[model samples]
Target: MARTPADLLADALRRDAAAPLLTDYDDATGDRVELSGTTLANWVAKTANLLQDEFDVGPGSTVALALPVHWQTAAVLLAAWSCGAAVLDTATEDDGRLAEADVVLAAQDRLAPLEEQEPAELLGLSLHPLGMGMAGYAGPARDFALEVRAHGDFFAPYQPPDPADPGLLAGGVELALGDLVGTAQGLADRLGLRPGDRVLVDAGTAAEAGPVAWLLAPLAAGASLVLCRNPDPARLLQRAAAERVTATLGVQIEGIRELGRPA
Candidate 1:
């Protein structure tokens, strides 16, 4: 029933702010983080403030992303939408989208190549476990972690994006800001995402499926996420059981049904 990303977030927060909205695990580092709706909203708010105040990003502004699936990536996506900015996934640099982006946010490791392209603005994320700034790297790009934490934990967009304004651009798909929630809701139906469902998603699938399937669909369906990065096959079953995962993506867990499977 939500018309926009902000509306969806507000509805979800009102539904259950104390519930775990996104639970993240990184087998590569043995790290786990659980964020309640309120906590995730706080992060979103801060990032939105950073985008709006510093970069003047709004309706027509395009924010290109070059990062993996992580908790911070969720915040960044939500923040950009909240500020009424269009997000473009920069998986292929030769697409020519990066050349026109108002700002580009990339992982520290991906900065060197992006800098050579000379985008209008570039920000680097270290993807630090503690949310710290880039370490031991001298790059022309601004540090996202160092700047984001200083922003206010609240944001108000200068101009709310119209329903017709572009919201997400990936590959050949383009969606309007107003149609985002609807698209997510439709995907939830196809994926069989149900309210309060604890869904497990692997990093590779999230990357390939894009945000519509991995992130927004879950939120739109009123479900929570158990996102695993660098998943280890040996620990897969144990982790799913521990997380109480009811549905899965990318892995064939016998007891749990795979998302998008025909009933």
Candidate 2:
């Protein structure tokens, strides 16, 4: 069993590098992007390198993630952990946690409120479908897309994080690196996730459930994801069929077995 998210990713690379790992769909904007295991790993490697080389992020560094449940968010989370840094998810900006972080990664639209707080380091993400840099905006934050490209395609942390070291800080929850991996494996089992399973998840649920449900669990179980944002009810069945979805979460599709339900 994997002891960290990075280990889970390495396992996937060895087991299914060519398989589709993430399929993101935004019903509101009609945007869709698919990433294979190799592609996702490449992004993760680049992100980890960016955090380590440019920002000097390593073991014990704390990164506040303020982005939505998108594919890029997954890469950021994995990269942070790979560097042995702790993640503080201020998705709701709960209790001004972002002020406590050593670095902040936020979407462009969320940068306004954070500007006043003035975190030591801030990286703005456009969340563009093509993963492009922010357009025509002068902000106090660095552009993630622009800086990330300058980093190497591989990462090697100067100091690897110990399994018992802190890995996440969310609200009142504090989890160690080992705890995150353990919980991920448990959640995967509870959801009946298995190799070759293409799990379809509602984006709203992914956001609400946090990384454990929508990210780590799938990786730990060796499964892929089809994350749907603002899914149209009328087209849900057709999409599921076309995607060959084998399991689901957050949406009640009659014939599709919901995760954790009795078989």
Model 2 Cα lDDT, one tens digit per residue, 176-196 = 988998998898998898877
lDDT of 2: 0.88
Can you write out model 1's per-residue Cα lDDT over 77-150, one digit (the tens) per residue?
Answer: 99999988889986764456785899899989888888888889999999887688999889799999999999
Regions of model 1 farther than 4 Å from truth? 93-95
Q: Model 2: how far is 66 from its true place, Å? A: 0.5
- Give the distance in Å from residue 119's predicted Cα in candidate 2 to where it truly belongs: 0.2
RMSD of 1: 1.4
Candidate 2, residue 134: lDDT: 99
TM-score of each: 0.96, 0.96
